[model samples]
Target: MTTATPHLLPGTEIAIESLPKVSLHDHLDGGLRPQTIIELADAIGLELPATDAAALGAWFAEKSDSGSLVEYLKTFDVTTAVMQTREGLERVAREFVLDLAADGVVWGEIRWAPEQHLTRGLSLDETVEAVQAGLDAGVEEARGAGHRIRVGQLVSAMRHADRGREIAELALRHRDRGVVGFDIAGAEAGFPAGRMRDAFDLLAASFFPATVHAGEADGLESIRGALLDGRALRLGHGVRLLEDITLTEEGGSTIATLGPVAEWVKDRQIALETSPSSNLQTGAIAAWGDAMVDHPLDLFYQLGFRVTVNTDNRLMSATTLSRELALVAEAFAYDLDDLLALQLNAAQAAFLPVEDREALMDTLIDGFEGAL
Candidate 1:
């Protein structure tokens, strides 16, 4: 599905892949190369649903489209199975960055749960070090190949697991190394961020940033817990926050009434990391309809929300950051300026220093100007 090549601006010569971009919600385990997974699983003697790389990739795509978040998560068993060792973690992280670089991502944050990588006796600290080493090497490799990409890790704790505070501490310990932020993911419907109150409290006291996985599998209440309890600066697939918005037409002018939660999110410009294909695959946008055009992303953009495109799981969604932007551009008839504004929105919302974000924005401007 990532074969969605660089799409032009409808009637223009600008190739979207040639522009600078930012990825804020990519997953480490979920972005593995099929061949990499095949080899890794082979070495570990783990039984795969498909022996061949192509079939394995297809299996992931099919399983993820099962339309239940719980079923969608089962595919991770294959990915995380191959990711239990330091070598697996490092190699996957390395290739993850290279793939993003190829897709024109100048800045990215890769989120993963460290607790899931300890089956091979690697400690939390060791797991982070391994991934960081690979990310650092990937950056150098990309730069050597004439691509400049910078990345940071978003350490996530599984919400249903009891290790939230532990993972938060692990993230804090690696902040100076390569960690950028903390997040909680997994089974969002029954497991809210409030379940991790101690973790959020600890992260809050340290003034660390978090982006909660909310509104994808749940509704406004989960989003509320994300902001009030998790203190999230961003929302991971917060597409369902639209449920809090009521829309109508008066005299041919659209009027949107926002619930208190939606009001705060829109008014504060909290970024929504909307992954198009992933949202559709996991049935997150079932209320709106089951197509990219039906996605609330365009509506959110029109209503002034800081909606940023993402590939939540590149392998599962079979997408790249470029492909996601291209899909949305087609769905909404977006122009080059609209795409540039989306990238700028992401740059501003990145978990970077103001000066660094400004530099990224400048780079985007220069590349976009060249395209124009």
Candidate 2:
């Protein structure tokens, strides 16, 4: 589903692909190459709906754009079906990093649930190891190819499952290896982050950071649970947080009033991992409007919220980080400086140490300056 050429800034000669970027909310299972899926499915004797790579890619994009998160998520069953083995996990992870590097991401955090891959007799720890191995190989390969990329894992627990603490421990166990943070993903409407209080409590005690999938399929209360109960450092697809913001016209100026929840998130500088195409496809921003111009990301950015652009599912959305940025730029009329600000926001919000984040910021500044 990727385009044949790099996406350039709307009225400029700059290719967005040339700027350094940081990706904080990409999904590993949601970014596999179509050809890789076909080969992996073939290895497992799994019959695919479409044998051709391009057709399979289109199929994922078609199914994912159903405007229902649940329906959109059903496409993962096919992607994950092929990701049930060690080789499958490694190859997908490696290619995921390579794709990110190709899209100009210098640092990326890939999130995936290990519990979903145990159907092939692999333990949760083994799954983490396999993915990390692939990520390392991808990083090495990218460096060899002169891309110089780095990646970490954000091991997730399925919200519908009862393995919150188990997955939390798994992430903690591999913290020094490659696991950088923790998350809980799945159906977000009924499954609040509070249900995994014990898991969040454990991570809190250990001082490990978390990014919860709230404000996407759910509303204000879910974001509340993510912060108060889950102690999330960032909100995954917090597009719906705009619900708590009230706008009114006063003397020819639009004034925005922030609710307590919105105030806290804004005051604390909690990053909103906003994915435009995926958000539109999942109806995460339906309350605002269905069009890319209607996304709250620009509003959040203008209001001084820590907003960062992302490609939540590259394969599902048939997009890359550069494409997401280019789309947002076209919709919002953002210039090179605005794009750099967004990248700096993401670099700051990344699950990395202060020195590392500073180094990444420097790299971004240098790269953007070079482009100018």
Candidate 3:
């Protein structure tokens, strides 16, 4: 299906795309329009596997669905190739916001590593500024179209790279200029958050919020590092925390026993930004199973963990926030209240200040209530 096509869940006449939503884990590089990628590649003289937008999109889905993280990441080479230039980055970021607006996202945090964009002669700071410009322009465009939406940048540093400190400083510099928070995005397995202690410390000194990618590619130890060292305000795709929970059959019903890590996360209400399709694609949930129904999101939710749904890579996973929600709703048999609880979890865990977060929660509650 095309990116514009709305995928409704079974038995729900209400289009999922019409429900107000919040997207916290979407990537700027991973949300590029296939048609935009083709044109941008053509503009920059880059070769692509498929010239047609539909075929190119299909190619991305197939590659990502291979259940190999390395192969899945290779798709970004094409998307990032087209996004190297200023105009490409601007256009992509602008369109990312517009697409999220269309998908009923009233607020979103678009995360990408600025260090990755410098291969085309742009400095790290310049890249952040360019993305900010695009975001501002997109917000204006959305307003012109009578869609009220707000987006912020989550400047991500490559965890394996040595430039974490620089990227953290860049985020701090741009904190008031559209950059909302800091993150470390790439290669979560070997690169623990402790490895970027200097960057995390710098951000901490500035009292900045950070969200680390943990429990997706790696397991509980990585999550430990994220909480202890990275001081992460949220866990990006932290689905594997379920591994620490032991389910025991007592009588006929099942009872969940939470390990220390899982208990800590649950007690603290650390939001798990679980991306269903991307989790399946990257084999993050391979230990659980291959299908969306097997995802640990339901377990976490049932256990009273702060569970929030996300689209980690929209282009690669070929999903929107609404689509991801619909998929999970179909698999777990969720109603509007379940969806609202997820949105409320996201709003509470949002990087916004307390007052703004309350406002967002109010907006979500009112929106969902009106729809009901």
Candidate 4:
């Protein structure tokens, strides 16, 4: 069923919710609907902060607004708890896809750590299978509802956990079945991508792609490890990549100098999965400034960096891809062309084959052209 979506853009009749968008860094565990969470939790005798859906949603929003990444992550405990069962996982995943479809996400890569779903005697493989089943159903459901949407799973290994290699293997095992790529998520400060070197080595050997959570809770050294060790083709919440860009104002114009790291990321055109609301909530953009306009996405885009907007955690940030796009457009004063460029950047960086990605690009081009 298509959920009703309010137009995020106010004055323009162009509905941002109907625009073609690709989400590269959405989290499976972080995108559950509040009412679904209530039902799922009730099924397992789990205690929730609030029994009512609205209050529960408010709790998540409030908890996530703490401006500390560590503090913000505590809300996941409740979400992950309910997802321990097959039913819980499937329902959440199904609703997740429906919500994305309603918000006009044409392509999305949903990431989650399968290891966390093992508390109910489910093996890692079982967890992946459960989620894949849900994703399959969701895709069909969305299609049946006359919404053309596609979602891929990015199986993530929790960096704070020691199951990186195992999760990578699990992802490879299901590559043909819905799983699209691999990632290492969770806390990023202490656990750099190098800490999962064995996992990265195997993923590298298997010719699999990865997108590491770097430059969010940490800095340049962490991003360096993601590229050099984790072999990441994309940076999750890489909002901190701005640390490498030095901007100096001379007279009335601004002069920007790219540091070695920024230059490399720019030259390689590696996609930065930037989440505006999430970044601000977690203080990821503090150094740049304390506003959404402080985000470097516009700067990155204008400078020719492959930048893609994302909702790192929809539930945590309480955001949809459309809302994120609207906020970015408002912050940067972007027009429709800028939006098309962002979608094209994401389509190009997708883990699919070159032909498939080009096809996605064509779809976006046609869709955006039609919108005009």
Q: Roughly what TM-score does model 4 have, to 2 decimal places? A: 0.98
lDDT of 1 at 283: 92
User: Between prediction 1 and prediction 2, which has the larger lDDT?
Assistant: 2
Candidate 3 per-residue lDDT, tens place, 1-372, comes to: 125567675676777787788999999999988999989988888899999999999999999898877678888888888877789899999999998888889999999988888788998888988999999999999889988789999999988889889889999999999999998987787889998999999999999999999999899999999999999889999998988999999999999999998999999998899999999999999998999999999999998999999999998998889889989999999998999999999999999999999999899998888775
Is candidate 3 or 4 superior in lDDT?
A: 3
Lowest-scoring 10 consecutive residues by lDDT in candidate 3?
A: 1-10
How high is each candidate's TM-score?
0.98, 0.99, 0.98, 0.98
Pairs with backbone N, CA or C atoms under 3 Å apart (clashes), candidate 3:
none
Alpha carbon lDDT of each predicted model: 0.92, 0.94, 0.90, 0.89
Q: What lDDT does candidate 1 reach at residue 118?
A: 91
Candidate 2, residues 45-108: lDDT per residue as tens digits?
A: 9999899999999999999998899999999999999999999999999888888888888999
Evaluated at residue 372, the lDDT of candidate 1 is 67
Where does candidate 1 clash, by residue pair? none
Arranged by lDDT, best first: 2, 1, 3, 4
Q: For residue 131, what is the lDDT in candidate 1?
A: 97
- In model 3, state the lDDT of residue 154: 98
Question: Model 4, stretches more than 4 Å misplaced?
Answer: 1-5, 8-11
Cα deviation in Å at residue 122, candidate 3?
1.2
Q: Which residue pairs clash within candidate 4?
A: none
**Candidate with more favorable, higher TM-score: 2 or 3:** 2
Cα deviation in Å at residue 258, candidate 3?
A: 1.1
